[model samples]
Target: MTALRIDGPWFKDERGRTLMLRGVNLGGSSKVPFSPDGATHNGDRFFNHRDVSFVGRPFPLEEADEHFTRLRAWGFNFLRLLVTWEAIEHAGPGMYDEAYLEYIRAIVEKAAEHGITLFIDPHQDVWSRFSGGDGAPGWTFEVVGFDITKFKETGAAIVHQTHGDPFPRMIWPTNSGKLAAATMFSLFFGGNDFAPETKVEGVPVQDYLQHHYIEAMVQVAKKLSGLTNVIGYDTMNEPLPGYIGIEDLNAPGGIVKLGSSPSPFQSMLLGSGIAQNVGTWKLGITGERKVDTQLVNSSGVNAWLPDRECVWRCNGVWDLDANGQPTILRPHHFTKVRGRRIDFSDDYYRPFANRYAKAIRSVSPDAIIFIENEPRHVSMKWGAQDAPNIVFAPHWYDGFVLFMKSFRSTLAVDFRTGKVIFGSKRIRRSFADQVASFKQTSKESFGGVPTLIGEFGIPFDLKGRRAYRTGDYRDQIRAMDRSMRAIEDNLLSYTLWNYTADNTNARGDQWNDEDLSIFSRDQQTDPTDIHSGGRALAAVVRPYPRAVAGEPLRMAFDIKKKTFFFEFHHDPAIEAPTEIFVPNYQYPEGYTVEVSDGSYETDLVTQTFM
Candidate 1:
């Protein structure tokens, strides 16, 4: 196998054949540790993060071969392998888990045995287990004098475990706009600029946090340095801007408007035990709208340290007035510095991404650095010096399907344009346009670099998990087909959201109620049948041109017709033959193939039509 590299707007092999990557996020549970019951809903044993192990996450070494074989059979040669900050160094700063590192290396080797290539994804949700998500270690909060146990009571965060049963579906994402995550991200990225007076152990908070994160990832690079299959490292998963450039802290924080919505100022007030009325929005088939206003955190929980102060307060953004009421001290503290307007991506995210790239390349010089913009921020301009050997890896989703938990092919809504698309033809066109726009952003802003849709897939347990009981996955298939069609329409490369080995109908990804994994255990009644455990195989398993002989003009697949079509202008200089992955799952009885100008040979054993 030859090494893959970025060349202009497409990925190329060592022989310079244009490559199209199709794969899935290895597993969803990689975000949490395998030991000590790190499931988000398990509140009893989460704080003991110092004595945890991630040896069996994704899957144990013994079970790797079976999973890998299934993936290869489904035609996934590339992977967005997941690793987390907590998985690498959960014990504390400067503490590396040699055992976990060895296990990861072994897993990578096993993946290579089955002809799979992958890039490391340092995955995270809101922030950490303590803050209702997963990524940073528990000690991260402690370093800044935050008590993890009191996060819920202080109105700083909402956790599924502490909040208990009947957990609102998809509410955990709201944490990104809440107090705890917003504050931590602000400090992590802009502590020196936004919170100048807030320090952790005398070191600037921004430097301390970024340094440790880079150091941890560097350790991963050092371990997998010479491995050809490990091509690169993602800068970070869905990096957030926090409140860095919020013109008005009193206004809403992000684009997501489902469930409880609070402004940065309101979040600060709530964390300080001030009861305030915040707007609440609800999502339906039509779209999201402000249903009503509700008073939250009225229990008077203080998400701050006892006798300690809010970091923003210590930074002089706010202070106690003469009557013991909180008052704004510097209204424009984060909005501007020295009379200059601030933009989160240009001012903060870009610098951190460059730093991460440099640190990783210091160990593996030729490694590609995958960069992602903040999920909510508008795209920023990229120049030559921003980072070399980079790939624009942004995430996209079928917003309606993801949030509504239902599929409606006839009616689709475009989140970017806020336009409601009618009919299946229009919906498919809308989705394709949205995805292509990301590629266009890469070319326009970053000098025509390669673009990979880092994350995109549908929730398998849709329509109240009806398929689990009835064994009818028609809805799931339709939803997934719409997303996959978009990928094919743009001729884009992407890794589907995930394939969790431990996915069960009851627990669903071991975090929140997100059951997007393409594989599940309960569905695997027959171990010998490779597709037994797979969910919505009709939508996921499709024919694609793995490696093209020249520049690819267009590619499409008709799932209902069981037909595949690909057209490319042959490049006479390149000797590599075009390789198309023809999955047996898509054509069980064997189907006929057609080519325009070239004679092709079929290799049934490898399932490739060359």
Candidate 2:
């Protein structure tokens, strides 16, 4: 097969045409291949538990082939090939793991053989290997004199949480260890304070690390460049804020600098080779005086550490000299530090995204660039801005916590005042507004580039007491149906939260342990029983409906009449289908409905037009 060349706005073959991706995230395959709950506290290190070791490791290559091939059979056209920075850079600084890179390439080639396009995503969790996710090596923390082992001993929330394993999609950015890792990266990678002499062989620590990160990704691209079905690249997964300003990398005043602060790397240089006067010295990595700060100590102590003095470095504040009454530092840290917002000004986001886009184009010019934006980081409009050939990949989640009744069962909350934002009507409005904003943003940011719904999904384990009591599962299903209706109305492409099990049969992270599979893992169920269903419906349906201008779509199922086989005019006002798949039951109308063919009868339970 010839290599695929993506030109202009659409994802096309050698022949130019628009393409929509129907896919699932193989999230746990590369790094956290095992279940999230079983993840060990020792970073990627093994504790011999049999469980944690497998987290994110590719299942046998043949198993991967089977998984990818099955997805193609299901009509999925793309795969978000998740690879972590640690998996490829674990050999330490400046070294790319050749064998690991090859391992990823083999999977990509196999996926292509199944006609699945690959989107290389450098996935990370808390931050790095030491921070409880597959990412940069444990040695990354050592660069700053941080002892990973000590963090585990004291139960550092950044490295290990205090209570239960906070499941995926639950840990809020403002208040987790993930934020700490981001801060460290901001300092080390973005050129914050460090000892003057502290350098990686004369190069700053941050520069060296960024170089390694870029190289690993470049290598992954180069190795798979010949694969036609490999479609795109997601540069970094869920980037978090660090100890510097949220806008530090592109702040108006400029990126934060640590001026003369003592860096651990500098301290190491002084200790090893650099000779300096011993009298005038600094005991800590930073010399700034302490002040009242809301910053939670990673050590869990209330006392302040000098290095943590620059709260603005992590929270996005600046000292003003306009009035000039006096020079004063301000407290910008929030109770939700990870929730600290990055300013959306062009000066900030444009540079941030463009940098990554440029890096991607440098390595894989023919690949379509899928850019994902955080609903929290900036407004949805942020996705609209920046780069040619970029596709906006925004995530959506039904505020799982607010509606969560127990560990298992849950429901969707009311929209406006509901607990979580994603599933509510208000969020639906926001999503609509974003679609408009993205269209406008694309014009300004990426030259009217095509966009897609990058991520969206809800859990399926709606069983047990919690599910039955609140009917949370059912409500969530209804809300999800409505959500998909909206997406379909917009004519957007999507890749649902995930594929099969991850051991914990939870939401997007399930390791294929439950009945969620389209193919039964059970020996009991007959393979030919179409009713022996896989939960593929959750991932398959496009939420909304689409129609050409001046042409509204017709209704197939009628809710008011409670019947099927009834033909009706299209309703342009409604973007999503009023009628949802209740499952199993055929349309009430006498006409036999063919779902695969979009034909059904009435008092057809026909819903509104898309």
Candidate 3:
């Protein structure tokens, strides 16, 4: 067997090249619970068992080792290790819990023991601690003029609506008031703005926020750099589009506006004051949401349709003001704000990418950078030249047919042909074509840059029985297979959306049910692993290849009987051979086989028992 180096990228060997990206997301939000005594599994408030820990405490090191070993035994080569900005800076700014960093290091080292690669993702849902899930600490929101902790008491629609069970994580994007305010403040404080009022502790707030975030990330990167398999970092989970407004195109002249308003569509900063319609932003405002009928503009009034009604009924953000007139106030930041064709041709996003890349590399140059493009701009035609790295990453979703408005699935209307594909019976064609485009674009974009389907899973445990039929877990897997096969069939790599322990019964509501985790919160000392959702997904993933000294290796599996052909690559070497570990399975007549490499033959049963 040949020893192959696989720190990152696919490992090449003579027999079968092993794709190096069989990965899963270890949900990071459950590190510490808002309620310590609250029902939690592994110290996190969502699950009932203590199998996993999120709140700055170390999950039993032995358990961590076991988890890694299990992942390897199950044929996973990578783990998307998630750590939140909040976890590092929970106490306050300029303070990172040194102990937690050590724990992370231990986890990485343990993972290495199991031959797994680790990619540190600064995970967050809807921005930061103030919004939900984890990222920047709660204090960071104060720079945006809002106390995240106060949202619980203020009865703000965005905050209050999410307080119930099954925390509506990303759903806040459907409304954009509070999120808008927060983003505006972040940009105002972080950007080049030097206004006196925007100062935090006498320093510009934008600078302060960006500084703290980068500092925290640098600390983690430095601590984990020594680990061989630790790859790059996911800079910040889904950065917001900053507070900019877009117009209701259906209005006369297809015109849009640029200002904050409660609406779900993601807004993008076209260039400073100029903006464009992208997707809906989540509204986060304090007190009862005001709705004034007189404010409605008949010329551009968007009637309450069934699909649009939910934005209003669920207390979601809408562009309409309190009186129902469009307002400039836009919601949350960085939800699918992708780099545009124009931006690329003109070279606009490079500065942002360069700055972020530099910050990460300063601490860990050996790490492989994983970059993502906004899905809106990352459609079938887009290519990886737009974003560079060993990992040309992108996300996939089944669109409105699955997640609906709660998710930012856009209605497909071929902008090139002006043909609406959203409500057509040929929807599958649109979906399939988009997926195929990803493969073709990856090759064309970066000359076959290593691509990874960074995200492609869905929320399960919803009340409706029809959800699965409509693409819940099972359907999500099927759709994911469509994308996964696209990657696998194309020899691409990937990591599933998540492996949180919060999925069953929607225990960790903090992640909005996006916790496509495998573990169930069964508190039994040794619970039956009936709901280990990810294990069920194992069938879809291809196994890792074993190679030696730069020669390819071949291994065959009997899917029907769960067995492996543990033969080495063809080599005319010395006589004796050693036995290798193969998948255990039942052979009714007791196993017996002959090993041959065309020129030689070996009989195992006739060999010595000792």
Candidate 4:
């Protein structure tokens, strides 16, 4: 469990072995609060936001050993650990929760004891818990003159608490194109230019927002500053550009359209209390469609505070005509600056990333920075002047399987092109090629840095929760195996979507009705068995070379055969043997191994073949 450093396209250990890191997102429920039972399904909003605590997010101190031991046994040496700005600064701006910071420090220390390494992921969904996702605190919107409670009525954003139970499936993502999230993100990233008139306490919105967010993370860095296992920090999880690059505000701008879908201009009008006939969309086997139009904000509820005005209106993106109707004054306001077209990744994301990288590295100079690109968009090209020691950490998902919660080995969709490819072999190739494209992007865009699939997994409660009822997980296994093959074929490093300690069959990950977690308490039928609650272990706990002495040329594992193969050209400069993880779950009956040249020893306790 030595510290790792970046070596071009590979992560090298203290022994100079090219390390292939396999890890998982520590847990999914870290998105919400632990107290007041803030699970999205509960629909409770009485608790004060400032008084909330995240002391026991991934797990409590006493339960750390149990979760960590399980993860270590599963052969995970890395973690894309989840944290949130709300957890750090929910009390208000510059009001650091010292107790929670101490709790996080203890958690990181315990993880180090388990031989696990991790980077802090400032995880977020659309924007915040009040906006149908989780990341920023509620007060963030308040400072910018937003009333989160009015979001639901105005169709500014959707919230589980206000939306009530049986929330629409996979609809939370649509919040990105809504009024609440789009406005906040635009203000956070580009308020100086777009919302020139917008300010918080006389400070420019962009500077005011970014400064506080970066400082909140800096608090965590200061707490865990000296811990060697605290490898690095993620800039932000799935940062969106809001309306930054849209050429037309009238056109739809969301990726997954469900329920009432509004254009950027329509969202602004709705937030400003103007009723609009927004299109209602539904997802079917054929894909998304505009089923009908729904009149939103009929009661005329405004999303802004009582004394505040719409930021866009003040900036002249829209205005009230002589007839008291909102009119689009600048349809392409976000598309350009001073008559020059803008690229969201280049103009906005890169500058923020650079600022974030500088802020975090001030604590630990050698700390690696894991960069996640905007969803469905390519990362901006990096030059010699860009941040160093970065890894192109991107996210991918099988759209058909993820949303539909159904899998067929013979059928898969190329989400990039939205075309169905109907063949098992072709589907597998497409999956592998999809991952390879990211690696290629790393070479071209990020100057040949290492690539990590920050997040990807399957829904355990798939096929209408059949497994939960019948206790059969063959479908989940097949689906997970297919995904693992894609990664293994590419020989890429990755952290699986998640493992939530408190996950249940009914509640899923306890946020947004997503059941992507690989572990659930209800599935734990045997208390003594460490692997009982694990949803799909057959494909998950497979053989992988933990450390290669030189350049790894090839690697593969046969799920059916239970046979493993790995090859690498030895480095004469460093004479350390390659280490392979041979999990006992895949080999219960004492297995044998053969090497091309030298003999290897087995450590049954650690489950390693060196």
Ten consecutive residues with minimal summed lDDT in candidate 4? 42-51
**Distance from true location, Cα of 17 in model 1, Å:** 0.8
Per-residue lDDT tens digits for candidate 2, residues 257-278, read 2112212212212222232221
Rank by TM-score (best first): 4, 1, 2, 3
Candidate 3 lDDT over 245-334, as tens digits, reads: 223312211001111232323221111111223322232211123232122121322222222221211222334567864443423222
Q: Which one wins on lDDT?
A: 4
Better of 2 and 4 by lDDT: 4
Which consecutive 10 residues in model 1 have the weakest lDDT in total? Answer: 250-259
Model 3: which ten-residue window has the lowest total lDDT? 251-260
Query: CA shift at 583, candidate 1, in angstroms?
Result: 0.7
Candidates 1 and 2: which is better by TM-score?
A: 1
Clashing pairs in 4: 128-133
- Which TM-score value belongs to model 1? 0.97
Which digits, one per residue and each the tens of the lDDT, describe model 1 over residues 252-355? 76546677778888888888778879888886766668888988777887777686667887888887799998788887888898899988899898899889
The C-alpha TM-scores of every prediction are 0.97, 0.64, 0.64, 0.98
Off by over 4 Å in 2: 1-16, 33-58, 132-134, 152-169, 172-179, 192-199, 246-359, 378-387, 400-440, 462-476, 504-533, 536-610
Per-residue lDDT of 272 in model 4: 89
How do the residues 373-427 of candidate 4 rate in per-residue lDDT, one tens digit apiece?
Answer: 7888866878889899999999988777888889888888886777887889999
Report lDDT (CA) for all predictions: 0.85, 0.45, 0.45, 0.88
